[model samples]
Target: MVSSSQPLASLIGRKILDQGGNAADAAVAVAAALAVTEPCSTGIGGDAFCLFYDAKSKTVKALNASGRCPEALTIEKLRSLGFEGDSVPNTSAHSVTVPGAAAGWVDTVDLFGSKRLSLAQILEPATELAERGFPVSELTAQFWKRGEQRIMNASPNGHEMLRHGKAAPAAGEIMKLPNMGKTFRALAEQGKAGFYEGRIAESIVKTLGDLGSTMTLDDLKNHSSTPVEPISIVYNDQLRVHECPPNGQGITALIALGILDSLQSKGKRAFLDAGVNSVSYLHTVIEALRLAFADSKFFVTDPEKVHVPVNELLSKEYLAKRAELIDPQNTKAVAHGSPANSSDTVYFSVVDKEGNACSFINSNYEGFGSAIVPEGCGFVLQNRGSNFNLDPNHPNALAPLKRPYHTIIPAMVTRMDGSLHISYGVMGGFMQPQGHVQVLLNMHHFGMTPQEALDTPRICIMPEEEGRSVVLVEEGIRPGVVEGLKALGHEIQVVTGLMRANFGRGQIIVRREDEESAGGHVLVAGCDPRCDGIAVAQF
Candidate 1:
């Protein structure tokens, strides 16, 4: 089964699977295809992260494919350019980082792919689509059109992203990215060096330099993806949930789940019996997540640059302490617990016939990413550097050659014996972990299927802005539950229609390997109704 927000991209991934490629190969294929079909979320100019389950070994491995800031770009450089306040401009050339996606793709294949397929073979489907063009979907077109003016004004070479050098084409219009196709073809023929050391790298340097950026060719060449052990927590002693380590927000889900487990242990909680949309269940989860975000924001940074105490934060005793802060009857802003733990993005998963599953996510930070495109590159340079904290005392402080705190994370669930059970993720700026926890609980505790899990009305605890925070809920949530949450201290906003995109667009595929369904596995797939996406399964 292969599922993505874009139909053509999903079809491309399934094509790779049909050709005898493993899940890892199909993952790269899907990601590359989505780059062509959904430019508003990801590109070769961005970064990626993955959680891969090796069916042969019953082990889960993680890859942190995110990039770091340039060696010469520092807080002082921004200040010298008259930049003010505690943040950098999202649209500035300075916000661009050395992209890690292309290098990451090669590494994923090297480590997990089968010898039956080469990088060129894996990428052929996407390369064809980018060269020949595909019709834009309604939701993606709406998203793309919103960024047309921003891309034009902020990027020196942004004129290339337009239709006839005017506005973006509407939904159903065929859009061809010949330059992106050219770049993909180069990667296919020459491998990683095609992206890191040759024409692609030169375009990166020349374009950024023209826009007053400090990025250089060497910075592009030096970037490499790291293989890391995935971190997980056994939830309710029945299932284990996995996420990548720091520099990404995967831990936010673990921390929130840890707290919920603690609360459930206290009887102090109903677990899930309060009804799916009950005010009590919603309040409990929201408050726990708010607390988790507080800690995640305060502590998560590049592990190479800072020490994030993952063990101490996810510790049962520590999580229990954090859970103790939640008042089941009411809601309020919760503060961070001692340095504990832990966007415009795309999330997709593929489970091959052999049970090897790849849960992957890639992103260009925010919309159209710095709104900057390299000359003739047909992709946006990510503004991930804008995530760095300007405070010198902060752990995520802006520095040379260091990664900023990341928000994109992919999640997976495995049975006690280490078999892959669920591969899932939710994509939005900060709604990811919130989606992870809710969808997970909806399935595990409430017995909802994958579709029901995603269809449930969601809630997001917005980051604290100037010490004021609000909880945004979808309109379909029962009116009584909304009133009850407001009755508690929550300053609630009910988002409706297209605005509900703030919640997120997610995908999931569940695998069943029980005796009743032996020999062949049953693939239950679900795609987010909020976006123009579908899940495709092939037995």
Candidate 2:
């Protein structure tokens, strides 16, 4: 089964699986295809993360393929550029980090891919999609249209992404990216060096440099993917939820789940027994997440650059202490506890017939990234560095060769018996972990199917002045629940008509292992209705 934000990309993943590729290969193919189909959200110029479940070992492994800042770029440089702010401007060239997705793609294949398929073969489908062109999906077209001005005015080579160098492509219009195809072919033929060393690397460095960015070819050459042990927390004693470690914010989901578990242990049933989407249920989940965010936002940074107390934060004792702060009937002001913590982008799930699963996410921070297309590279440079805080004392503050806080994450859930249960993720800046918590509980506690879990009305806790939170409830949520939340002193905003994308787009593939089932496993998948995507199963 393959599920992703773009239907054509999902088909490419399915094709890879049929062609004797494993989940890792299918995932990379989908990642590349999405780069062609959904250029507004992801590309080679961005970053990617993967959580792969190796069926044979029954262990989840993580790959942090996010890029680092240019070694010469600094807060002082931005200050000298006459910008005095807590963070770099969203579209500034200085915000362009080393593009990690290209190397990340090659690394995932090299590390977890089936040896049967060559890199060139795995990427050929996406390369073809880019060269031959495809009709633009409706939602993708809307997002592309929204970013048109940004690409045109802010990007030097922005005309490359535009239709005829002027307007955004309308839905159903065939859009071709021959330049991106050339980039893909270069990668296929030369592997990692094809992207990071030769013509493509020179183009990226020269383009950003002309825009006053300090990025150099060496930054691209030095980039490599880091594989780490995935961090997870046992949920409901039945399953374990896995996420990438700090600098990626996957820990935020674990911390939130841990807090909820602590609440359940303390006799808080409203979080579960009140039924899904009820005022009590939503309120409790929201409050727990708020507390989790309090911790994650304070502690989640590059662990290599700072000490992140991952063990202490996920410890049962600390979670119990944090759960004590939650009010069943109302919201509360929460702060970072000593224990510690923690989007944009594309999230997809792939599960091969052999039970190997890959939960993957890739992204360019914000739409079209910094909106700066690298000369002939046919992709936007990710403004991931825009996530960095300018306060010199902050742990996530911009520093030479350091990764800023990353929003894109991939997730997986495994049963206690060490079998893959679900491969999934929710993609959107800040809404990611929150979506993970809601969707997981929808299935684990309420017994909803994968589709039901994704279709349910979602709520996002948007930050407001003075640390207050305004809950953005999707349109389908009952009106009484909205009023009930407001009465509890929670600020409420009902989102509808296109603005709801802020809540996020998610994908899920649930694995049911049964000796009697076909191939001893049944794969059920769901794609987000909020975007242009689908879930397909291959026999």
Candidate 3:
């Protein structure tokens, strides 16, 4: 089963599966297509993380294709320039992180795929669509209109590609990206080397330099994708949680789960009480995130440069100690020490008939990704650079060839029997971990279907600096629960007509205890209702 936010994209995955590809193959194909069709959320310029579960081995492997800072970038240099702020300078040059999506695709395919498609073959649809153009989706058009100034100021090439020398393209306008076509062509012929070391790299370096950015060819050439072991925690007798490692706050999700596990083990299942547990769990997790993110801010640099105790963070003793901070009845207003820049990202999942699975999350930071289209590359550069702190003393401070604190995280859950249980993810900067915990609770605690869990009203506790903590609720949340939450001191914000799609865009695939496979697309899947994304099965 393949699930995506777009039905057409889902159909593409189903088509690949029908053609005899496994979950990983189909997911890669659909993701490639989505890069072209859903450029507002993700593209070749972004970074990706994935967890692939292999049925034959009953083991899961993680791929971290997160981008890296340029070799010339350093905390001292950034501080010396006096560009201190929570936000990164929004320009093509400053926005560009070493892109890892293409490399991720290559690595995933090389490691697990059977009938390998050349980069050209896999990306041919995107290239053709880029050249011939496709209608701008309503979502993309909205973001373009709202962010036109930044798009224009990001880079000359960006202005040319996004606006065709005019203002930002309107909704339904035929948008073409000939440069992306050229980049795809080179990748198809030369593989990753084409993008990292050849003309594509040269174009990126020159464009960034021209825009006063510090990226160099060496930074491009030295980028690599690492396979890391996922962090796991036990939730109950049957369920186990897994997430990407540091630089990403996926551990926040684990922390939340651990807290919930403690509550459930005590036989506390009151629905409203469970809601209280949910909030409390989030509170503790946020505190842990505060500490972990403090480390992320100051110490979680590239694994090559810093020593990260991956095991210690996920240890039971640490989690138990963290969970002890939860107050079952009170809502605490936590402080947001620093804000990570938000990104427009996408998440999708695939589960094959044989039960192999892949949960993938990819992002380009903000919408249109710093809007810096490299001349002749056909894609916007990612503003993941904004994730770095400008402060010289910060752990996540800009450093030569270092990985920034990341937000995109792919999630997986397995049964004790070693079978794939679920593949899922939520997009949004800080909200990702919060969303993941909510969905997991809805499923594991409430026994909801994947769709029911994802479609349910969601709440995100914004960084406390926003002062009043606002919980944006979807249309269907229990009114009494809202009242109860309000009574508990949450500043209630009733969002009419979907306040945030990120709260609901999660996609999931589940393997039931009986060995049946099921899949779900969130309510936002109907953003383009006319498209076809029905989940299918083959016996």
lDDT of 1 by residue, 304-375 (tens): 989998989899999999998887776665554221110388999999888899999988878689878888
Structure candidate 2, residue pairs in collision: 296-342, 300-341, 343-428, 343-429, 344-429
The C-alpha TM-scores of every prediction are: 0.97, 0.98, 0.88
Off by over 4 Å in 3: 90-92, 163-173, 266-301, 335-343, 466-469, 502-504, 513-539
Clashing pairs in 1: 343-428, 343-429
Candidate 1 Cα misplacement greater than 4 A, ranges: 336-343, 516-520
Query: Candidate 3: deviation at residue 405, Å?
Result: 0.5
Computed on alpha carbons, the lDDT of every model, listed in order, comes to 0.86, 0.88, 0.69
Q: Against the hidden true structure, what lDDT does model 3 obtain? A: 0.69
Q: Which 10-residue window in model 1 sums to the lowest lDDT? A: 334-343
Give lDDT tens digits, candidate 2, residues 327-439: 77677766542211113589999999888999999998787889889889888888988888898988888899998888888899999989899999999888899999999
lDDT of 3 by residue, 303-343 (tens): 66566666775676765665555454655644334324343
Q: Of the candidates numbered 1 and 3, which has the greater lDDT value?
A: 1
Tell me the number of clashing residue pairs for each predicted model: 2, 5, 7
Best-to-worst order by TM-score is 2, 1, 3
